[model samples]
Target: MFEPIIPLVLFAIVATTTPGIATTLSTASGAQFGFRRSVPLLVGSAAGLATVTGAAAAGLAGLLLAVPSLQLAMKVIGSLYLVWLAIKIGRSGPPNLDVTMARPNSFLGGAGIQWMNPKGWAMGLGAAASFAALASGPMQLALLLGATFGLAAAASLSLWCVAGMLLARLLKTEWQWRALNIVLGLVLAASIVPMWRSA
Candidate 1:
């Protein structure tokens, strides 16, 4: 019983820690707003991802897999959204430490990202498919996967936020800030490859 769960835990860790749109946004939010104010975004993202995981466990992932058209549609929409987000990040100016000057991402916005993020969908689908045999029933599997993913997401997002805050200190110059944003934006845009391939 526990043996099967070990692999699931490892998968969750890897999936959550890997760079994706959610982590990218969390990093950007932390750089601009610091860890304190970015809490809601992080929380919302985790909740949204957990919900996705639950849906996957409930067989939505299988449904998507059976319908290539739906999967392709999701990929296209998610990729376009990521590209848009990358553009927004690339255009953003230096962070104003004064919270009043620039607002951090809102909770709803963060949740929305996860809801549409291709990586999040992939993670949830992979996790459910990989670990479905471990549980005795569907509800049990859904709860198990959702809880594990939620915890992993919380930890990974917090780490990314902290890393972003630390990087913010080093990005004092305008050029440094611009360079960082450009790199992050490019990385976000690059995620489209896997999404396309999966389709």
Candidate 2:
């Protein structure tokens, strides 16, 4: 019964920790809001991860597999949203010494991102494919996957956010901020490719 849980946990770590849209946004949130204020975003993302994982365990993955059009719709919407987010990140100005930068996202936004995140959907679908045996029934599977993945996401996403906060300290000039923003934005937008194929 418990044999499958080890691999499931390992997969959860990789799924949540991998550099993608969620990590990028978390980093941006940390850079602007710092770790303390970013807590809501982090918690929201955890909840979102739990939802996706649970939904997948509850037959969402099979439903998606049966309907290619639905998958396409998800891909297109998710891609567009990520592109818009990327542009927003790229356009953000350097930090103001005396003033705080705009906090563009919060708990709701964080949860919404995961809902629109192709990578997150792919992770959920992958977990359903690989670890369905971890639990005895659909509800059990959903709960198990949700709890494991959510905890893993919170732990790993925090590291990325903290890294961004640290990087913020060294980014004293406009050029440094500009370069970092462009790179992060590009990476976030580029993540759609693998996610597209995965879904």
Candidate 3:
């Protein structure tokens, strides 16, 4: 059981560090609004993911797996959303610090996007399943797994966001900023390949 925790921890770390809605949003927020303002969004998303994963471990994922149609629905919905997000990212321009800084949508928008993300649900469920298999007691194991994964996710995401902010400082010119957005967008778009193939 204890040995299994190592693999589980690695899985959580990889899942959290992977570029997706939460990571993208955090990076965007940090690049635009700075880390201080983005903290709430990070915390909220981490908390939400922990709850979702724990619920999945408690048999919610099993229920979903049992329903073929529901699983299909999730795949379709998630795929479409990922594509939409890629398009949105491609269209995004450099952060207008003045405008974005004044925007109130950062925190709630970041958290909401992550909460609805289908890939996130899948990952959470998968993590829950693995943890459940090795856990001696369900609730205690879930809590332990949730806390460990939650912390990893929150920290990794915050680091990504902070990195984005730091990178923003290097773009002293408009072209550099636009180029950065384009490159990041391209990277994110390319990431959808795995998700599509999995679907």
What's every prediction's RMSD, in angstroms?
A: 7.2, 7.5, 6.8
- Worst 10-residue lDDT window, candidate 3: 96-105
Worst 10 residues of 1 by lDDT: 93-102
The TM-score that candidate 3 achieves is 0.60
| Model 2, C-alpha of 164: deviation from truth (Å) | 0.6
lDDT per prediction?
Answer: 0.70, 0.70, 0.63
Show model 3 residue runs off by greater than 4 Å. Answer: 60-110, 168-199
> How does residue 148 of candidate 3 score in lDDT?
73
TM-score of each: 0.64, 0.63, 0.60
Encode model 3's per-residue lDDT on 48-109: one tens digit a residue.
77766665555644555455355455545544554565466556665544334354234455
TM-score of 1: 0.64
Top of the candidates by TM-score: 1
lDDT tens per residue, model 1, 80-154: 666776687677655544333257777787778888987777666655554555666667777888889888899
